[model samples]
Target: MSEANAPRVRVLVADDHPVYREGVSRAIKARPEFELIAEAEDGRRALELVQELNPDVAVLDVQMPGLQGNDVLHAIKRDGLPTRVVLLSAHLDSETVYRAVASGAGAYLSKESSRERICDAIAAVARGEVVLSAEVQAGLASEIQIRERDQRPALTPREHEILVLTANGHSAPDIGKQLHLSQSTVKTHLKSLYEKLAVNDRAAAVAEAMRRGLLE
Candidate 1:
């Protein structure tokens, strides 16, 4: 069908990683069936641009600097944006998969999925079909198994990063400056990490996190 005759799919991409975002944009542009309307590097921008663009579909990264993919999805719902969301991520657990499924996302795609798979995901979401990549499915299964075997403190990727920095003798202010967290936020994380790692000092906390594989 002609581009006009066929249903045109407008897409918005939201990813914090610049390389992945650009790769996705390039992949979409190389396809004939999809038109990429705008690009966003963070969750807030994603939500804002989606509202402005009113694209037919939005490809969102699950872990962003603020307002994660699901949070952005909620914002879209709250604002009644016309865009349908397709969550893209490098990692997600079974609980997260089910949660995203329940959160009105149109699709879930792992970043490791093939280029053709991405295009298919976009097309499927535009058609109101929910897509799940094979890698995403497998990762969810593996994550569930690991979760079942775990009875320890769970920290976010950013939190884990902070834990590592603090262990290396960085003060809260220094950690905040490096990771873009506030001083109070850095201290809060340090306190939480100390408690979680069962350490009384920064060195102890770092050692514990490293021992537990929470940090490199």
Candidate 2:
């Protein structure tokens, strides 16, 4: 295959973490079939880059101080950019995961597994497939079953704990350490929780949980 014709998966990396954002940029640049077209440190900037670059894919972090990845996802869809968005985030709970997916992200990929996983996910989303951690997919399934059983959530013990942490703005790794589970496990539970709650993202989850009096 000739170099120029190699699918040329140009990308935008959006994250506040210099290390992660740089790493993602480098990872794509190092590969033959991929290109790092631009980088953004926050949602506002990400939007600008998307408009200016119109990359094939956007690899974004879920939480930015402002204008989060979800907002970017909406913008990409709203403005009809040819770009597809893949969320490369630290694990959010099942609830957050469900919301991320529901928000129309092309793919949801965890930062913990992103070294190789991000590339794989971007490639898949470039091909028009939704993607997430394997654990996330299973957790969504289980959460659905539970919601059906009760017509509401009967959060597993771990989910109950995660719900509280999520409310407090604790990152997935923090919740995982507190709960003695891996970060991915915490994210899985959160993804399921978000689905059961019928919410689409963290702010909504926190607001809904607060309204329901589920956390302090």
Candidate 3:
């Protein structure tokens, strides 16, 4: 097909840093396959443009002012928008990777990535593929190892059962009734499990349990 006939991938760039945003804008403008639809210096504006423009893909800085990239991604998902997202970050930390993957972001890349890689990521995400940099993979690997190493073996069978029930959305009284234990007993078990998992609440305990592979 002719270049003019080719479908252009509509893109929105959002970042708090002007230099990086301009660099990305220039890169997008240089590519014929990509059409820069809009740019925003904060997450709130980014979200507004996304809702208004409905671009094919959104390239977002992870640490933007107002709302963060992950927050925008979550909002997009909650609103059931069709725009795919690619998150850019200065570092590929485990929490960021976790949120990106969990929130259905199409790509996670470093701000230091080359222009070619950035363009490739935008195209990849526009094509509905998940793109992860080597740095993100390494961070994920390290996160897995840390979770494995910190796996809590001190949780008793009852505690594990309680956690699994809690993860399944059971209330403490419901779990107690199902397990033939008193509500106080269930709460006590939950407290002990939270201590072992280094969490403060049932929700955190459940999330930590799932992360550590203690609850499948």
All models: lDDT? 0.83, 0.82, 0.91
* Model 2 residue 155 distance off true place after TM-score fit, in angstroms: 21
At residue 83, give the lDDT of candidate 3: 98
Model 2: what TM-score? 0.64
> What value does the lDDT take at residue 119 in candidate 3?
96
List model 2 lDDT by residue over 69-152, tens digit each: 888888888887889989877765677777678777888877887567788888889989988787678776766665545554
RMSD of each: 16.0, 16.6, 8.0
Write the number of the candidate with greater lDDT, choosing between 1 and 2: 1
Predicted model with the maximum TM-score:
3
Question: What ranges in model 1 sit over 4 Å off?
Answer: 1-4, 138-216
After superposing candidate 2, which stretches have Cα over 4 Å from the reference? 1-4, 146-216
Residue pairs that clash (backbone atoms under 3 angstroms), model 3: none
What lDDT is obtained when candidate 2 is compared to the true structure?
A: 0.82
Higher-lDDT candidate of 1 and 3: 3
Most lDDT-accurate candidate: 3
Q: Model 3 over residues 1-216: C-alpha lDDT tens digits? A: 886898999999999999999999999999999999999999999999999999999999999999999999999999999999999999788867976887999999989999889999999999889999988998877776776666656688899899889999999999999999999999999989888888898888888888777876
